[model samples]
Target: MAILVAFGTIDGAGLARSEDTSVDALQLHGPLARLLRPLVRLFIRTGMTFPALSQLLRELYINVAEYDFALPDKAQTDSRVSLLTGIHRKEVSRLRGAGAPVNVVPAALSRTSRIIAYWLAAPDYTDTTGAPLPLPRAGEAPSFEALVSTLTKDVRARAVLDEWLDRKLVSLDEEGRIRLEEKAFVPQNGSEQQLYYFGRNLHDHIAAAVENVLGQAPAFFERAVHYDDLSGPLAAKLETRSRDLAMNVLQEANREAHSACETDAGGDWRWIFGIYVYREQMKPADKDIGKDAS
Candidate 1:
């Protein structure tokens, strides 16, 4: 997620006031560029031209300004949206009718994720040490069929198992028990499921950061530890250690959340707790720049 530095307060209409608008825009430039660099690389790799992205961004700007920044009790007009977003009024009117993008999580993806969560968190599916237990293919409450049944009765357990096996998420052992892979929760690389999660996770993370920067009360928990100039071996070691610690935290949170939701009166609210670990080797130029700065 990009680190945002707020230069001004948002008005009731959710816009930076005119007086500080330029300053806020200038302050935002660097972080926005940094954040988009990786995304731009992805766009290029996926053969998305600049013009296509530009049009998408234009629509998104109009959409956000129209719906999110509308003045209270006042009908949002194309003129106002264009003014706020700096798009032409005609374009704003044209695209506003196009509607905001819908983010629909695939039914299979949603069900699969929840099933994995249960396997990792539900008392019936986990061992005494809180680790997920290998389960027999069918029959009985702690079996694979039972685990899937808790989430959905519409889909057959055999079908889910077949898909999981195809995706390398689970495997059958010599004892005929189904075992979740070490990274079972992670969707297969380059698959649509992975792309869905890629967007969702990043969106939630960046949204939290944006809210905090906007000076929301009781800031969302956002913190990180960073160190430069570590040896290759040390970085690897730290990555492994961080993975272990992060997984423990995630699993415990999942268990607590699952238990709470079991008795939760349904609500419109949603929550996500995510963790990421990254390690990149410093380039020679970057090292030189660091040394010069020091």
Candidate 2:
């Protein structure tokens, strides 16, 4: 059986996936193999291997089965855990004592994020039309200083303002009022923020994919368009186009999501919508490598 995957490209570019390859019901393993190649390379770069990561995965699987799954007694036993994770009962017991459990908590919003969130959503800081209000630099009430005060007294408004100014998140007029230049907290030219996002975003994303793979109903939305042969200039243009389009959509979605959460009586969920563009240089073909013999 062949499958037809329609891939719409960025701004008139097309991606054509061949239908020659056999597409079985559970043919997902091929994609998984492709995904794992770079992941395995990443592991090797960080001095890790399949065995250690596999053990960690097994431990996590058991932990989730015990705590998350609805069992008959709502408690996990060695035999039950073994059955769920395909690990021996003795190994399950050993894993329990091997290390501390990894706590999967909601990623806490930073102070900067909180301030930005409020600036974007709070009625006091935003106009009636939901646009961010240009705020007076400092005052007793209804000012940017006041907003920062409501968030944290320990962190002075001057400190926050300086940081934001340095990052170009906000701009100050000659009159000293500050205007929000962006709707989101963007860490300008910094690896720390990017690295933090790398861990947090990928963790939730992989968790969603794993849940769907494990037969959880109403699977999380995970879809992408991948193509192999694009020139660097074309790829760059596509990336710029994607970034603009994604940001426009996400900003509106962010407003709606935050508004709904704020009005809801029971705030029982945490969610993140992450958009990223990745481009990498492909390795030379094996035949070319042999010809070069470097």
* TM-score of structure candidate 2: 0.67
**Candidate 2, lDDT over the whole model:** 0.67
How far in Å is the alpha carbon of 202 misplaced in model 1?
Answer: 0.9
Show model 1 residue runs off by greater than 4 Å.
Answer: 1-23, 99-102, 284-294
In the predicted model 1, the residue pairs found to clash are none
Candidate 2: which pairs clash? Answer: none
Q: Lowest-scoring 10 consecutive residues by lDDT in candidate 2?
A: 3-12
**Residue 29 in candidate 2, Cα distance off native in Å:** 4.1
Please give the lDDT score for candidate 1: 0.80
My TM-score estimates for the predictions, one after another, are 0.88, 0.67
* Each model's backbone clash number: 0, 0
lDDT of 2 by residue, 38-104 (tens): 7789889888888999877877776776666647766578888788768888888877545333333
Give the alpha-carbon lDDT of every model: 0.80, 0.67
